[model samples]
Target chain A: MRFKWSNVVLFFGYLFLYFPLICIVIYSFNESRFVSTWTGFSFKWYKALISDPIILRATVTSLKVAGVSATASVILGTMAAIIIARWGAFPGNTLFLGAITAPLVMPEVVMGLSLLMLFVGMESFFGWPSRSGNITVIIAHITLTLSYVTLLVQARLQDLDNSIEEAALDLGASPLKVFFVITLPMIAPAIVLGWLLAFVLSLDDVVIASFVAGPGSTTLPMIVFSSLRFGISPEINALATILMTILSIAVIMSAVFIYKDGNIKNM
Target chain B: MYRIEEIIISWFSELMKKIKGRHFLVAIPYGWVFVFFICPCLILIRISLAENLIASPPYTSLIEWISGYMLQIRINLGNYMVLFTDEMYIRGFATSILIAGTSTICCLLMGFPMAYAIARSSEKIRGILLMLVVLPFWTSFLIRVYAWIMLLSPCGFINNLLIRLNLIEAPLQLMNNSCAACIGIIYAYLPFMIFPLYSAIEKIDYTLMEAAYDLGSSPLKAFFSIVVPLAIPGIYAGSALVFVPAIGEFVIPELLGGAQTLTIGRLVWNEFFGNMSWPTAASLSIILLIFVVFPIVFAQRRREAKLSIVD
Candidate 1:
């Protein structure tokens, strides 16, 4: 009886979760301009996407920002993980930790506004950053994203055998050599997962980008927001479907890797 | 082992011998936070105190504390006074709080059952079920909103189907209102609610629940007395995650709420970029910041407490 009830609950649960997504995917091949009535299937939307210059430009810009932001975030995050998790943590460490984690919980509007205010202040107080632009956006992304890298790397760091570094040190290798040769390689997989997460988040982020991006800076979600004024577009369905595919795969894989230990006994 | 340790230690000591600026290791994250996050937040507090002017950005003097409280720009308490004095900002803030709170409660309501189901399912089935929940959110969010439009529209799917079934003669006007916005908000944030709850449910000891049953308690009592309290950590985490974002939410409300609805998030967006009232937007944002920063910062501290435990 208990099992039967759980099955029923699970059925409804899955239905609620997937209904809209499945609708969108089905409608991606949708022929009607009206997102509702299904006339017939066509690849026209996919084809139209190739020819749309604005979306194409936005896609490229998004890719560039994600790439740059992810790389920068990963490096800093790795350093943070190493310092805080692997090696010597400074005094009052958790406060520094709190500041790092603050961005994840900080409302998007607050983050964007605060960043804009900061840039404005910098321009006035020091005459540095004389004007606000992509530099500000990149900096904002870095501040937010680095924490993800740090958190992921820190989790990985805690599971690592510290004695490995000791062994390398005992073998006549210096701390720098031990880090590069031993610690870096061991945490490489986690670093990759962290980088991928940072990249995808950077791409999907609309709220922050809308506020701080430079002139003519059209990220994918930003364009999506502006075009939303026009109601639903078939091409958007195609774009969203693709992004969904990529992000899902990244999320699943990361969870699989990160959650490996929890399933160890079961496996 | 002793000889090997001696050799390894000496070689590592040689490598560290030349490296300087060990402090740089700590400097990067510290420097970035100070210049970017901490200082900027402090600066915003300062700017919020300033008076507004048209010609200049945030036009007003920096500090007019206890003595010069009347001057609008000279750190007068006017912005804050206006925040209290005007009902619009107050109402807007209230609306944001109410909507976000409702949405978070709704998430908990819908998500707990689903998460429990996922937790109790067979391993293979659980994987597939979990995938289904996450897969939709992975899709285009806007398109999903559009999907709701189709379902809720007068001539759309749900209406059409209902009419065809003779369930109702007239189609209900569903879209372009607060109700639609609520549906959309819940729809969008559902996955967030589910994931945290699911993970938490997975961690629960089934034996404990069974023990409650064996104690002759009713299933209802078992759920309320045993299952719910144990899941509080996940519930808190999920609500914080959902509520914080939902409070600042603009895209969903703007897209679905149509013309009738007004939200603090949309209000802020409109004030800055929409109305081009940059100073007002800045001041409003400062107000929004006060409300958001307090709960959100407090929540993170609580989260870190659990997080260290999880690790």
Candidate 2:
């Protein structure tokens, strides 16, 4: 292939994107506590990170919130996607679309503030969900991540062939049965992708979690944000390295799976 | 027991039959969004008009019952007035727009070529390239911003290398500045800009470019005249994606912009968390929402108009 100017820009662009991440990964193993100086390789920081109780508890909370929020977002988003793509225009369709897409562009600070107010209002009125906790954080995350899931599934649904579902329905299958047996399987990949996206979004959230979470509940990002105020720490580097490693693996596996699925469909 | 169970099942089935499947599907998500998303925004607006209080909720109710058959309503415009009159709040909003706009332009410049290259590549490599762009996004956003801290700090990698090479007498003042914040924002949001641009560029008819080239147009001329014009939608989409979130980005500005930089996000965060003034924070949020939502609604209306015209 002939060399082009675009290739040079692309090369530098990718380097710019990956260089900082790679620096963190390499420095995580540095024996020196300071992030700049590299002495020798050691896993001592990793051990320290593992032993930190705050990090561990925060991680557990983050995982639980991410799992539940992602599942809920996927279900709700899929239903919304189906309605938008398959149900045709209906009353309040414009409002529905606006609400679905608003979160995608909404500022995190605004979203957090508004949701916190809602929870506080609910508490005063109903005297339930007495305070912000994991439940509140989960609800906030579900709202935040729902838009992403809906957009993904909606794109997939629009591209889908409707004749297969129609054929199933004509074959004396109930609409519910046709949805389960035919449509769901066809859109399963998109659903899975949406779930993973939501999970990552929830896990990565700090601003919203900080607003909605009470003093009793702290997620991993909140802990990291607090520690980061003291400047760079080797433990954060270790934690970042671990998170990056797991995320890289998950992303690569999903990419490969999607690519393979596409190839099979082409065949 | 059997008779009761049968009756209950039949009633439930009858109720299900009464609700059409499509309505049920629509109601589930619509109701969730209405309660969680819409209600919160409405409450935010209401609270923005309420007076600050020292009570647990921290904001006084807007409406009160003075007596039987009598009503009293209190609307505090002071919260919004503070946002407009206070130097800190005004500067915060100005700095946020300026920084977010600058970073968005940088993202466009940096992402365009990368997106174009990926779009022009072979199909096999295209998928991989797209995956590469999306991979970093899945990792921690805070960690990514923190990575810039490690890179741009005085004792960080770049400075260390420069000092070792005798390139400078002292480390440059790179960290804790607006420039660093811009760089961090650009790095973090470049992928967002590229995805929309790539999708748009990929759909362009290369034949049009070829046709322009055949008409004695220079390659650069052809690119500007043909490719750029066609990619306007993508540019708008990508710019919106980058600019909106960048304006309210608390982490990047807080970490990279240092104490000197006063973005709206940090202002709201401080007002809410530091001062514990819920009304002021709510007012800030409402203003920020107006800044964000109005442009989006305008764009959607324009697009709808365009579509209707085509139809």
Candidate 3:
């Protein structure tokens, strides 16, 4: 009975987790415009999604912003992580830690408004980032994802053995060379993880993107968000299906990679 | 692969050398975070003190230089006063807290057992189970929330399924209610709750549980005494993780919540975007921030104090 209870709990939990996702995928092929009610399956929504220019544009824009911001965030986050994990006490170290991690717990709405205010304030003062658009959106995303990336890398860094780097340093390698040859390779997994996390976060963000996006730079999430308020659409179902498939592929690939890495380490 | 690795290493080394000093690398991110993260929050504080206006930037400046270096500053407390006096803001604040609190409890209930099961699972299955929990979180949050709308709408999956089963004579109105809103929040945040609890429960020495069992303690009693107390930190962390974001949740409540449901995030959104009342929005945000941030800052201080003692 105890074993049965454990199985029941896990079954219900996984059911709750994946049922809605399966519904979305199934309904994307749904012939009916309405999400519910199973008609004969058809590929009409996916076809419609292919030709929808706004969604296509938003998808492209989301990809661009996510890519740029994720790259930037990884670089910045890695630096912050390195400092926190490796560097000893420095001036304003506590302050730096506080600033880097504040966004993690800070509410999205608060962060959005603050960044929006900053953009507006800066634009008025310096005339750079004159309009809230791609650059502004990227900056906001980098700020939001930086904390997450930093946390991931910092955790990895804390677990890292320092003897490897110390040995390289003793061999007369410059600090720069040592970091690149030794430490960077050691933390590459964390960096990659951080980048992927930052990418997903930026791609998924709606509130902050809504706050900072200009007329022409609307992201896919923003589009999905607005469409949701009005009513359901099959096109969105199709889009969701595509996104889920992509994410599943990514997840599976990474799982395979991790498994292989484990096997290699075991050998 | 070896050639590609060489290229990457050379690029990285050259990039590192381009920065004159090792400290400069640290300075880059440090400066970026200070300017972007810290400065914007500081700007929020300043902007919250300003008067709302109809002009381009939409708020009166808080600072002015008086004759010959005497700085004249005007701070508007009226914005905050409005938030207090206005029934809408007050109701919104209360409603948000109520909804978030309820949703956090819901997530905790659902996530705790699942986490426990995963922690108790075989090592191989545990990793796969953990991955399954985290997979949905990687997908678009907006899309996940939208999934609930499809499931909860009048013509949604659950209602249709029930109707087909003859469990109900007609489709129940499941969508656009506080119930749906809570469901959406619990679904979305369950992973956050589960992962922390899993880590916490995984750390428990199973030998203790075995000893309890040997002493003839009831399984429930053993669980309550041995597991629950040990998982307090996870509970607190999970609750904070869910509660803080759920309190200011915009998209979930906006999409899933009924017309009457007014969360602080939705209110802030409307004030900033709908009413164009920047100061009022800022003030409401400030109030919300204070409520949300106080617990977090307090907890951090406690943790720091504990850590200092340990050191």
> How many Å off is the CA of A188 in candidate 1?
2.2
Q: Is the docking of candidate 1 incorrect, acceptable, medium or high quality?
A: medium
Arrange candidates by DockQ, descending.
Answer: 2, 3, 1
Q: Cα deviation of B307 in candidate 3 (Å)?
A: 7.5
CAPRI-style class, candidate 2: medium
lDDT tens readout by residue for model 1, B1-311: 99999999999998678556556878888788778878767766766666676654645657445565754335556766876678877777877788788888988999998898788888877776776786676555666676776577666667777887899889888778877888888888888988888887898898988998898989989988878877877888788778877888887788877775677788878877765555566667677766677766677687788779879
What's the true lDDT of residue A85 in model 2? 92
- List candidate 3 stretches off by more than 4 Å: A263-267, B1-20, B66-71, B167-170, B298-311
All DockQ scores:
0.52, 0.74, 0.69
Ranking by TM-score: 2, 3, 1
Candidate 2 per-residue lDDT over residues A1-111, each given as its tens digit: 324776787789889989999999999999998865679999999999999999999999999999999999999999999999998897889998998888988889999
- Of the candidates shown, which would achieve the greatest lDDT relative to the real structure? 2
Shift in Å, residue B56, candidate 3: 1.4
| Between candidates 2 and 3, the lDDT winner | 2
Taken over the whole model, the C-alpha lDDT of each candidate is: 0.77, 0.88, 0.87
Which digits, one per residue and each the tens of the lDDT, describe model 2 over residues B171-237?
A: 9989898999999999999999999899889999999988987888988898898878778778888
In model 2, which regions exceed 4 Å deviation?
Answer: A263-267, B1-17, B20-23, B298-311
Better of 1 and 2 by TM-score: 2
The CA lDDT at B215 in model 1 is 89
